[model samples]
Target chain A: MLIERKWKKWVFFYLPMAVFIVFTLFPFYWMAITAFRPDNELYATWRQPNAAPLWTLHPTLEHFVGLMKTTAFPTWLWNTMAIALVATGISLVCGMFAGYALARLKFRGSEFLGTAIFITYLVPQTLLFIPLADIVRDLQLGNTPWALMLTYPTFLIPFCTWLLMGYFKTIPKELEECARIDGATRFGAMVRIIFPVAIPGILSAGIFAFTLSWNEFIYALIFMSSADQKTVPVGVVSELIRGDIFFWGQLMMGALLGSVPVAIVYSFFVEYYVTGLTGSVKG
Target chain B: MAIVTIRDLNKKYENGFHAVKDVNLEIRDKEFMVLVGPSGCGKTTTLRMVAGLEEITSGEIRIGERVVNDLPPMDRDIAMVFQNYALYPHKTVFDNMAFGLQMRKYPKDEVLKRVRDAADILGIEALLERKPRQLSGGQRQRVAVGRAIVRHPQVFLFDEPLSNLDAKLRVQMRVELKRLHERLETTAIYVTHDQVEAMTLGTRVVVMKDGYVQQVGEPLVLYGQPANKFVAGFIGSPAMNFVDVSISGDGRHAETEGLRLNVPDRIRAHGGKRLTLGVRPEALRIANGSDEHGFATKVDVVEPLGNEILLNFRAGGAPMVARVDPGVRLKAHESVRFAVDPERLHFFDATSEAAL
Candidate 1:
């Protein structure tokens, strides 16, 4: 009877979870194997004697070596990291103030202003990049990391603001009022009491902003022309495919390495991210 | 330790909600003044305005000798405890208590001493290192109160600080709060919807309704000689039952749907007019057979509350509760009669609701 119960539990819970894991991991498995497979094996027809599309008989690190040594992959990585970090920092500061004002302050047009900000977020980036591209050229910032860094906030700020606004709303208004009555000014209350209490939410917004900017593509593709100036997404796509001749191994290697940073960020702050989204400020 | 004077204070929200209208109050030093009312009755709004948390739409508020109409909350020299406790969730009990001193630029040693003193007073010394989320509801409320006391402000404002606790804890905390008020002896303005809290904790109680101050006086005065039907009803448990009655043509009695009551002689000038007759549940008793001026009623329900029995009965076409001896074995649907204390009968102008 116990064994039957255990079997039923496995079928109901573990089986579906294992299937989902495999389904999600299959694409990464294909990417990593292709990155390691020798060029001959990778391109060999299925009819070849030793050809196996799913697995490689002899794996090599040549693509990884080539990606690092032959290309400006390091420079691109540094550029992407620097631009995403700076943009996220700028967006977080602005979003914190804007979110607090929209959520707490009773100013004229506050509701209208909050709606206006959310509307800006709903404007598709595919269309925004056109006017943004023109502005980038006008400022002579094309081919520079500044182009992406400055433009990323146009969308990231709105996203962060809305997220943080929702988070700020969950906190009881009496906390701030009590702080004020406890002898802190409004700004002081926000800095000492509210910000500290909202750290999880802030961290969540920061993570979201970082991940969004890290994986951003359209603006990076339009603005940066230099190999070293490009972000991970634009750099790998632009450099690995020359006139329709794809360097599949190098492409896959770049993709695999490029995603590791974001994955690391998610893993380290996953608890904070969940709490931030749920926004449990118990007082 | 300061007198708070509010003169002609009014509050009108931007969206055109008149939350408080023409409220005037003079709270003496070291007095515990409780503002009691139903929800949306402007009691909390009036307290918030004094704390400077809500902007005053008109009139003047003076704390001591200074008019604080334009002062920010930090400069108001008052602390408020909210219903939800409102402790800083991220801070430990010690830091939460010290935050006010630190913000006022108190020296480090002084901040520690004051916060520690407050912790000691509140008996939360061992919980100093624990965050608010780690504490129970009652403990968090203590920390919230401790945070307020550390500053030694001139006045303390409490906004229903015990409404969150369970029944047993609420009684315990209520007693503790009363004791704390006496020890501190600071002027406090408390707001609560619970009439029992107002009666027990307040030296003076102000009853408000619909943005208007209905009555303000000592708790017993508000209970025994309420200024209006609203205060008479709002200031008691098992609220004062009211029935519409017309003064009889004889000039010394009143009549309702199915009964007649001897109108107290003091209200004789109101003869031949419609009025509201108010009587508290405790002022009623089961009538013995020979009792005069007793009205017949049918027992609807019997709620035996250990010490006293609350007999629900239909009298004069209205449902009412009469507090009687618990030994009275009454059952539902039984016929009974109750006699009210003639002197305790309240007469109010039917149209204005003002006590006559």
Candidate 2:
């Protein structure tokens, strides 16, 4: 029976898990190899006898160095970092307050309001950018970081609110009631007890919001007009591709470098992020 | 240290569910008042209204001299211990205990002193530095109690505070809570669904059902003379056996399908009327030869509970249990004669269920 169970587990769990890992990680592997492969190896066709498409015989940092020096990669990186951080901060504050009110407060049509916020989240970003672009023009925020900074929260806030609201609901109402009876006002209880207890949820929300804004394509592409003003995603795609010719080597290097910050963030807070989504406050 | 007076308290929820209906209670100073009943009995609702956690639809609640009807919980100068302990998960035990005082802006020295004192009293001084999740259920319960007591508030509200503990821990905590009440002398309103907790810990117990107060008195008084059938059935373990019967024409006997017993003179005025007879399990005993009034029934089940053996049988078309000495040897389907204790018998009106 035990051996049979082990065989079943191998078929059901480990086999699928290995397939999923390879499928997801394959793109990153291709990107890394292309970024390091010497120019001759990168451009060589599979028909060539000397060509090694699967593994590179020679590796070099020429593409990374060339991309960094020839383009405004550092400026784009800084812009992405600053915008993602600021947008995440704004969305998190709004999300925390909105989530708390929706989850905890008793009011007329509060349920309707919560559903309405979620419905807004369901609205596709593809359809939203048109009206958002018009608003950006009216506000004179076009071609500026403010365009993306303010627009990112339009999607980010709803997501964070929905997520944090679920997290807040898992917390027992007794905690706040006890705090209130312990001489803390409603606001005080929220700030002192509810917010502190929700740190894991908050961090997870921040990480998600940061990633969303960092990799955001449509609004950043449309809003940012200058080479230096653009975020990493738009800057690399627009500047590296020079019409009908894909700069695979430099583009791959940009993709690899662009993802390092997000990777580092996930690694540092992976434990908290997992618990935030899956674990409720249990006494 | 406070007298809590709740007058004509009524709570109607938004969806038109009337949760608490006209609850009037005057908890005496330093009294340990327990509100107990089955679920949805309005016991916890009444307690929350007193704590200012629930809004009063219509009524007035006064803590000491102040009318606290419109006051928020923080302004009521009361502390509450929740059923789940509700200890802050991130804070140390010391910080949890000191929170109330810190909120009230007490000096740092005073907060430390009070926290230490409360931790000492709870015998949890060593756990002061640990978070709530690090402690056991009993230890977390102590910390919750410590949090409430450290405030030295005018009143303490407990919402089934020990319900989460295991059976053994519950009993120990019950004794500790009673002792703490005596020592602190703070008026407390505790809500629970457990009758045993109410009976053992309450200076006075209030029994509620279906959003109304059924009876309020000393535990033994409520047990001995329940205002109605509900209280009689609710207050005792194994519950009071209720059997329907009618008084005989002579005003001498009560008769039913399986029982014919002499009616006590005190309730003979209602002769010839249909009524319900209530008998405590302990009040029925295996009859001796000298006993003139008795009933014979076949034991359906025998539960030997160490100190006492419970014999389950059918009488008057209703199932009944007799609490007899453990030495009584009886088996299922065996014939037994039980004498009902006439003095302890209770009669209630068939329709209203009120004691006669």
**Highest lDDT among the candidates is held by which one?**
2
Off by over 4 Å in 2: A1-12, A47-50
What does the lDDT read for residue A87 in candidate 2? 99
**lDDT measured at residue A73 in model 2 versus the true structure, 0 to 100:** 93
Indicate the residue-level lDDT of A181 in model 2: 87
Global lDDT for candidate 2?
0.93
Per-residue lDDT over B202-315 for candidate 2, one digit per residue giving the tens place of the 0 to 100 score? 999999999999999999999999999999999999899999999988777888997888778987788889999999999999999998888999999999999999989999
* Model 2, docking class: high
- Tell me the tens digit of each residue's lDDT in model 1 across B50-159: 99988999999999999999999989899889899888887888988898888888999999999889889989999999988899999998998998888898999999
Which interface RMSD values do the candidates have, in the order shown?
A: 1.0, 0.8
| Candidate 2 local lDDT, residue A75 | 95
Q: A181, model 2: CA deviation in Å?
A: 0.8
| Model 1 ranges off by over 4 Å | A1-13, A47-52
